[model samples]
Target: MSDALLDIRGLTAGYGDVPVLTDIALTVGAGEIVALVGSNGAGKTTLLRAVSRIIKASGSLRFLGEDVLPLTPEALFARGLVQVPEGRQLFGRMTVAENLMMGAYRRRDRAGIDASLAQTFDLFPVLAERRAQTAGSLSGGEQQMCAIGRALMAAPKLLMIDEMSLGLAPIVVDRLLDVLVAIRGQGVPILMVEQDVFAALAVADRGYVLEHGRIVKAATAETLKSDPALQKAYLGSDS
Candidate 1:
């Protein structure tokens, strides 16, 4: 746990008076993909928001050996704790290239930012082709790709993506999964919040199942895939 790229302990977060997450403990190691899967309204988004400091949270949280509990969202982002938020929240009126450039807004290294942009375009060539087009003009899958490309521009060491497959076609999701594997190969760890339990676990090194904001199960991806209870509830498997 000491070597974890992101670590959380006893984390509780919510909106105003309503509690959504309770005593959550999780870890994402360097160069690993950790999946957080749960039903809708089960506090999956809340957990991500807490880690990104977009919401109030109390408990020990650390990133790369530094405590992040007291850090602001921009501060966390500067430390490579970047979140590709749900809904592919792109600037609708902006060109795809402009949206991607927004990801490096905090960086001072112009050359490194450009290199990251090139890498992003290499990984998502469709984005490069549509660079001058307005972001909102793209299809659902294309929008998702642009959103991911924008995140990659931040040069994140720990990329936390929320709902990578949401509203995407099966083929597009497959392609994104392949891209995620490639990203992990490049040594950037990911902490993903996904609704498609099977797909999330398929690409994950480890997975955690949340029910009512509490972690009900935590196991290796292979073990989780074969779990009878999880299969019945999430994967629609009879056995």
Candidate 2:
């Protein structure tokens, strides 16, 4: 079996005629956590959407060695390429449990789905505690957890999370990233897009720096942490 879970080559995508991603190429190996970091308007979200096939794109997108560019979002989900999108797009009117159950809507294995729900609760006890509460009633951090748990219900092989640390307290973000690390330990590769560069790099095994829709640097987390250019551009200072 190949170690590369997801691969992209010469990816070019955008909205309408305006291109956002230009000649982008990257890879996520099985069980690896790869972070995509960049400043605002750097096309980080567009890249994830392109990989998820949510928008029209031109590229070689492969998952598990099979071409994925031809697949739709639903098809991609069926193949375990699940994305926890930015803004935690949960059903506001639905109960937390209901929203979570929706994640397994495509699944037919009742017993297996139940098992996965239990696992999700175990991973996030807060959700279990708030199962009866409407999703919109939860705190910002709690909503984020529900979003991730919902994606997990799909039993994805490659989990793509966008902006995991957005709009949360530092402590909350830390807790969420810890759970993500735990999830990675279960052998699921993660392609994470985060503006919280320090936190993202802390957990990432390798990372790519995207600027103006291009990958300007690819390096291990340790090397990226020390790059002066990255430090000045992303980390706020060259020192």
Candidate 3:
């Protein structure tokens, strides 16, 4: 836990008087992929927003050994903390290249941004081919790719993706997961919120099962894979 890249301690966050997350504690170490899995409205997205400082939160959030709760969203992003939000929120009217350019808005190093763009294109070749096309015209999978590419344009150390597989076909999800594995291979730590428990756990090093804004289970991916009780609770039993 001391070596964690992102650490949250007793994090309680919500909107005004309406509380959504209760005493949520989680951590992602260097170069590790951790999945936060739960049902809808279980506060997974709210937790991510809290970590990114998009929502008011109470508790300690430390990133790379520095206190992160005080930082603004842009400041947090500048410090290599980026989140690919739940919906692939792309500029529908802008071309693919332009959308990616938006990711580096706070950056002054044009040369570095271009180099990162090339790296992103290399990671997702489809985006390169469709650079001139409007983001709205691309398929859902392509849109997700562009969204992730836009995040990479910032050259983040910690990339948090929320529901990357949402509304996509199974085949597309599989392909996207493959790209995520490659991204992890590049040594970037990822904290993901996924609804597809089975698929998420298959690719995760470890997973946390969240319920009603609280983490009810935490286990290694292999252990969770064989957990009959967890299967019945989260994954659901065939019976």
Candidate 4:
């Protein structure tokens, strides 16, 4: 349990009169990269939303052995739980540096925040070069990099990302995956909800397969990637 950074059991959430997620259970251990993969409307994004307190939910949601179901989104951010949402939701009018600054809105530590900013630049050198450019003017992949860098400015313990590979070239997605690995090496666990099953499983330590708002499978990355049933259903091949 000490190893677990995010422990979710029987997590049920949805919009009014419509259930989007039900009975979801998963664990993200400290410094581990976990993937949640499934088809459209499988509730992958909803799961991350619930954890980040963007929506109402039920059941036990724990972070670092403490019940976090009652925490507000602001409180969650203070606890080092941050989400880099889908679609790279950057402020189109803001410069890259201003966008990153927005992520540290909850912090008052000047030195620490500056250090985090420097770390972000180190991780994504292109961001450093384009710090003054408006986010809306950047290419798709550069926007994605800025989004992740902004999240890191929060100094998150668990970074949840949704559809990270969406609308990006394959090469860009691959580069982001490598960056995620480096972030994990620096001790930030990640919960990635990706549509690209093969790519997600390749970098994840473990993965949960969500279908129809339920978790249908949980296993090590190798097992999930090699499972004949999973391969046939999601990867478009049985091999």
lDDT of each: 0.92, 0.91, 0.90, 0.92
TM-score computed on alpha carbons, candidate 2: 0.96
Q: Which stretches in model 4 have alpha-carbon errors above 4 Å?
A: none
Per-residue lDDT of candidate 3, residues 121-160 (tens digit): 9989999999999999999999999999998888889999
lDDT of 3 at 133: 100
Query: Candidate 4's residue-wise lDDT over 34-137, tens digit each?
Result: 99999998988888889988899999999988999999988888898889956899999999999999998888999999999999999999999999999999
lDDT of 1 by residue, 1-239 (tens): 48999989899989998888899989999889999998888899899999999999988999999999999998999899988857999999999999999988888899999899988988999999999999999999999989988899889999999999998888999999999999999899999999999999889999999999999899999999999998998877798
Clashing pairs in 2: none
Write down the TM-score for model 3: 0.95
Tens digits of per-residue lDDT for model 2, 90-196: 99999999999998999999998999899899989999999999999999999999999999998889999999999899999999989889999987889999999
Candidate 4 lDDT score relative to the true structure: 0.92
Q: Model 1 scores what on Cα lDDT?
A: 0.92
TM per prediction: 0.97, 0.96, 0.95, 0.97
What is the alpha-carbon RMSD of candidate 4 to the true structure?
1.2
